[model samples]
Target chain A: AQSVTQLDSHVSVSEGTPVLLRCNYSSSYSPSLFWYVQHPNKGLQLLLKYTSAATLVKGINGFEAEFKKSETSFHLTKPSAHMSDAAEYFCVVMLTGTASKLTFGTGTRLQVTL
Target chain B: EAGVAQSPRYKIIEKRQSVAFWCNPISGHATLYWYQQILGQGPKLLIQFQNNGVVDDSQLPKDRFSAERLKGVDSTLKIQPAKLEDSAVYLCASSLSPEADTQYFGPGTRLTVL
Candidate 1:
């Protein structure tokens, strides 16, 4: 009943430049959106979340995402990309009524260059 | 606080072979979840447990997979007869509150079947 879509399979950016990873979702109820990052051979880490209370959510490592109800999107954006930011990013969606059952998008691999 | 921990970071097995992976979530985390991430894909929730009780397992490959969280702390996932298509990284995540749904993930067990 709920689904997320990562529009870009890959996003390449240079260090110190802005990074953008697009994501969209469809849910019958009000949706909670999240962004998670995964380094090679590592687990996914929470980047940011939009709990419906705030449209613009700030997360660790200077990452942020804006939840747009009109567009049905919650795209992740960072002012600058660090070399350490090279990793795979995921878009997740869930319904508050469901109690932590999350739906994940395919993924977006970010390649940060020097 | 320590993050989620998983054992047997990597495992290789032949078709129809059985295998199991273990996970220890963060201390005091009441909600635990199991997910499968195929290469190039995001983590997919296979099961969710809240204090020793199952909340969801709709996406789980019930025919080939089984899991338990008896003590409501540590958990395990087993594949009775893995197929080549079963290769993936098994991720374990935990959250403080089931309703909040901000999950922290483990490094995961990568299983490769030939």
Candidate 2:
């Protein structure tokens, strides 16, 4: 079974500081990884996705994630945190040939403050 | 392009009652999916449809939960005899095809079972 484990249940960062959300994966084979963000009372938005093409994936809102195969990790990062960046982040995995069935990790809530 | 659309942004009902949520996928999207997101948890796939045909529903609780995309465009998810555990946000998403990696999401329908 393909699954992702979010290392932190909550992360707090001051405005303009760097932010990191850790995630580890357990998959039998190479898998598609994704980062999604959800604000309160809003729908989930795809932050980024990592297929086999590239290890470093850039996403909207100045966010990016690096897929480290050897480490079995895909961690989301941002150079500067903003108040708008406060939201719940999820790490998701999609196994090949599954017709887009996604397995999501328990989310990590981000809190950005001045 | 318009994103996925869902009706009745919020619903409240008593346990053992029934409720339904509706979704309209993006224009020309051939794949639709329903996901249940409990508070503090990432969304879980409940079902997937490929052009009006059920592609995957392994995780759905068929005894109490049902869903259908009758015309391959709009979809509906029904929960009969709702349980308190069933209270969660129901999210609808769609992609251009079953193999598409990016899925657009709609503002979810929040259901509360008393």
Off by over 4 Å in 2: none
Model 1, residue B85: distance off in Å is 0.9
State the C-alpha lDDT per candidate: 0.92, 0.94
**Candidate 1, residues B44-78: lDDT per residue as tens digits?**
88999998999988989899999999999999999
lDDT of 1 at B33: 93
Candidate 1 per-residue lDDT, tens place, A35-106, comes to: 999999888988888887979999999999999999999999999899999999999998886576788999
Q: Which candidate is the best by TM-score?
A: 2
**DockQ category of candidate 1:** medium
Interface DockQ per candidate? 0.79, 0.77
What TM-score does prediction 1 earn? 0.96
